[model samples]
Target: MGIVLNQSLKNTVITYLGFGIGAINTLYLYPVFLGATYYAVTNYILSAANVIMPLFAIGMQNTLVKFYSQCKTEEERGRFLSFTVLFPFLLCIPIGIIGLFFFDDLVYFVSKKNPVVQTFIWLIPFTGLCMAYFEIFYAWARVHMHSVFGNFIKEVGLRLFSLFAIVGVYFNWISIVDFVYVTSGIYFLALIVTMLYAFKIKRPNFQFYIPANVKDILEYTFYIILSGSVANLLLDGDKLMLNQYLVIENIAYYSVATYIALVISVPSRAMHQIVYPITAKLMHENKYEELNALYKKTSINLQIVGGFVMLCIFVNISQLYEIVPKEYSGGIIVVFMIGLSKYFDLILGNNNAIIFNSKYYRTVLFLGLFLVLITIVLNRIFIPLYGIMGCAFATLLSITLYSLAKLLFVVKRMHLYPFTKETVTSLIVTAVLFLAFYFWEFPLYPLIGIALKSIILTAVYLYVNYKLVISKEINDIIDKMLLKFKLRS
Candidate 1:
């Protein structure tokens, strides 16, 4: 635990810093500098690229992590690394040729509702290609037991670069169109830097031989590619569908609101980094009792924390929208719906980790595919009717249904559930706080009003949770903090 904590702490800080920069860029800089039209264009291109990235990489990044340590000798290791780097060419070559031949048709298809996308269609695949290889190289560094540098490049480095690029646009050094190109080129730059760092860690031997376990490798890679696509689709597919059904500017509105809702998941994301390995170990040791306790603990704890974030955001969403452009404020409902979905997912803490480690992992793949299919169908049905709000509703429905499915599957398979009486209490507390504060605003500026309301809400919320002892783990944390303060005094 100590070693893992020490190693991961810096990376975690770097990741949060990146998210901070991204939030600023999404909330203020992009909308202010580029305006709605170009912001929509850039976001659409990136979202489309992300959705297709799994296809481009063919799952080589994860494959490298899973199989790298299996090599008994340098020769085998070199061959495996070489294969991971080169395998994507098998898909890239054909895709490139197809793109070359049918470029206009492809552009026309995607840009039917949003013709602004036509000129930038090529950047989608190019950016996806850069993202794919960058991950492969990052994985290369990880396999050599040097992950911090790569993580920095992926998290902080890219965002900082974008911060500079946006600043460049502000200074009239680059056109909005040029900013898009520059952003895509940043991925290429990240790839080259990561590749160089990987080489510095342990220079590649560039062996041209197939690994002896090529059969198993290919099988695993095939499974991963399909499974990986499910996540990317769930994350970005709505934006892509919006491009087809609605005007592009709506995508920018959706993106801004979605970013606000995304903050609700931060606690869950951070906890998972620490909990994943422990969950895996418990499963390996067949400690069913402890695993079940952990399942419930994580669920309740995350519900409490994430629910707080959701409440704050939901209550202050109007103020937040005030900080952004007027056109972006129409996504108020988008924020609520998306935030609700994320809150539901938050309460199912460690459910994903358990499923990924269990024997029924493959079964969940089919379930995930089912989820992706349902998401697409819902988006197609709803986006035409609701526009950005419709897309948010589709997302909310698909994710809630998918989360319920996962919960039931885990309960049925392992006889482990993440719910307890405390879970219900946590929900009630969250609801009460939200109802109490939602209409209570300070007659002040947006920032000051938000701060005052949030501080009052946090005080009341924590007091109630402490008095009721909603979670033993949380109570202990509070006790520790208080004890330290008393000692210092």
Candidate 2:
């Protein structure tokens, strides 16, 4: 937990800063500068790329983290890493050739309903390739226990680039059309920087020979690719589906809600980047007792922190939306549904990391495929009926069902659960705050009202949780910080 806390805190700060910048871009700059149609084009292109990235990387990122810790020698580990790097080309080369031949047909099918996306169809595979290599390189860093810099690059550096590019649009230095190209370049830039950093951390010693455990390694990567694909589709699939069923501008509306909801999940995302390898190592060492302890601590701590984020979002949502354009106001319910879904996923802790790194990952992979099917079906039924709110509903249902299945699998398979008295207390406190703040708002300006309301809500929420000692881990950290403050004073 020491290393987890140390790195998790740093990663959390970096991710939050990234999301802060992203909020400005999504809510203000993209809408104001690019307009809804172009904003939708940009969002759709990225979503399509992420959907394809799993196929491009062939799940080698997960393969690297799971196998690196199990290898016995430098040569053994190096050979394994070399295979992860080389094997993706086996998958990607075919994918690229298909894209080259069916480019027009694929674009026609995808953009049949909304044609704006046709112009940027090529960007999807190009950006997906960039994202695929970026994850592989970042996984390279994670195996060496140097995830902070990679996380910072992935989280902050990319968003900063987007900030500058969108600002260029604002200043008329770049047109919206050119900014699309710039977005693809930003992803490539981040990948190059991260690849260099990974080389500096642990330079790859490329070997032509395949590892002896190639069969098992290939099996795991195969299942992991589907599981990874399912996870990403849940994150981005709704936006893509919306592109098919609705006008381009509607994606802009739904994307804003989804972006706000995703901010609640950033803590989990940041923590997982470093924790995945550690969890894999624990599994390799068969450290069940320590593993169980880590599981519970992460669940409770994330629940506490994730609850705080949701509180700030829901309580301040009205004021927050007041400042954004009125067209986006309809997504208030969208934010709530998606935010709760992500919070539910957060409370499950490192369950995904545990399952994906464990032997039972193949089982979860099939379950994930089923969940993805269900998500698409739900979106199909709901989106046509309810529009943007329907997309939110489909996502919430998918993540909720997927999360419960993962939680039960971990509990049954490992005989370990992440809930305790603290979990219940956190839920009670969160629910009470949600109720109390639902009707409360200030007569002050929107910005001042949001600040004041957030301050009051967070102060009270912290005081209650601390007094209850809902999580000894969280309380101890808070106590240590307070003691340091007192000592300095």
Candidate 3:
């Protein structure tokens, strides 16, 4: 927990900083500089690429995390690392060949409804391959307990670069089309730097000497591919479906709402970087008691942090939307629905690491596949009727069911649950703060109002959570910061 706390805090700061930059881009720059159509096109290309990223890497990222620690010797570890790198190419090559052969057909199918996508269709796989390897190497860093630097690159570096590129567009240094290319290139740059850092951590010996558990490795990798696809599909499939059903421009609006909601998930994403490898280690060593304790600790702590983020977003959602283009304001409902779904998942803590590393992972994969099917079906049914809001409804419903299933599966199979009395306490705190501050907006500028409310909310929220001691870890962090401030003064 000490190492987890230290690294998780750093990652959280880094993740939020990234999201801060992303908010500026999504809310202001993309809409102001690129306008609706190109903004939609940029988002669509990235989402489409993200949906296929799991297939391209063939789950090597997760496979690396799950299996890397099992290697007894450095030579053995090197061999496994080598295996992670080369194995993905086996599938990638054949897929690339097929994609190239049918490139025209692929373009026609993807761009049939919205031809703006036709020109950018080629970037999807290119960007997907880059994203795939970046995760693979990023896992390489995580397995060695060197997640912060990789996370900085992932959470901060990528967005920072995109900021520069978007600014270039605004300055007439690059056209919108050039911005699209720069966006894909930024992903490529992320992959390269992550690979370099991963190598610096443990220079790969580049041996194909397969581990004795090659069979188990392959089987896990296969299941991971399917499971990873399900996870990615759940996140990005909405955008892809939007591209299919609505004019490509609507995706920009939906992206804005989703970005605002995405801030709520930052704690989970940050914690997962350090927590996944640790969770895998615990499961590997059969530390059931420790694992269960971790489960509860992460659950409550994330709920407190994520609940704060949710409150900030939901309470100020109207103001946040006010700052964005009027066309994007239609997504207010989208934020609440999607934000609620993310909050549910956030309170589950390291539930994903538990399931993915557990023996019952295969069973959960089936559940995930079912959830994906439900998502597609729900989107198909709802998109035509309600448009963007319907897509949000479909997503909210699909994710809730999926999250609930995973919770039940963990409870039933492992007898480990993330909830404690603190769970209810955290929720109550969030609910109270939301109700109190939501309708009490200040009669000031939207930005200033958001700032003032956030300050008041933060002070009050932290004081209550500290008084109740919802998470000792969190309370300790607060106490330490206060002590530092007092000493500095």
Question: For residue 163, what is the lDDT in candidate 1?
Answer: 89
Question: Which portions of model 2 miss their true places by more than 4 Å?
Answer: 1-10, 68-83, 144-146, 199-209, 269-296, 487-489
Candidate 2, 1-489: lDDT as tens digits: 687678777888887887888888888888888888888899999998999899999999988998888899988988887888888877688878888898878889899999878888889989999999999999999888888898898888988899999989989999999999999999999999999999998877887668888898888788878877987898899999998888888999888888888889877876686678888999899998989988898899899999999999998898888877888898999999999999999998888889977888778889989998999999999999999999999989988998999898888889989898888889999998999997889999999999998999989998899899888878888889989889433
Question: Which pairs of residues clash in candidate 2, taking residues 3 or more apart in a chain or in different chains?
Answer: none
In lDDT terms, how accurate is model 3?
A: 0.91
Q: Compose the digit string of candidate 3's lDDT tens values, residues 1-489.
A: 587688878888887788888888889888888988999999999999999999999989989998988899888888899999988987799999999999999888888889989888889999999999999999999999988998899888998999999989988999999999999999999999999999999877885666789899889888988988988898899999998888999999999889888888977876787789889999999999999999999999889989998999899999978877788889999999999999999999999999988888888899989999999999999999999999999999999999999999899999998999989988888999899999989889999999999999999999899999899999888878889889433
Each prediction's number of clashing residue pairs: 0, 0, 0
Ranking by TM-score: 1, 2, 3
Record all residue pairs in model 3 with backbone atoms less than 3 Å apart, i.e. clashing: none
List CA RMSD, all candidates: 1.4, 3.2, 3.3
Model 3: residue 482 alpha-carbon error in angstroms: 5.5
Residue 351 of model 1, lDDT score = 98
How far residue 218's Cα lies from its native spot in candidate 3, in Å, is: 1.3
Which ten-residue region of model 2 has the weakest summed lDDT? 266-275
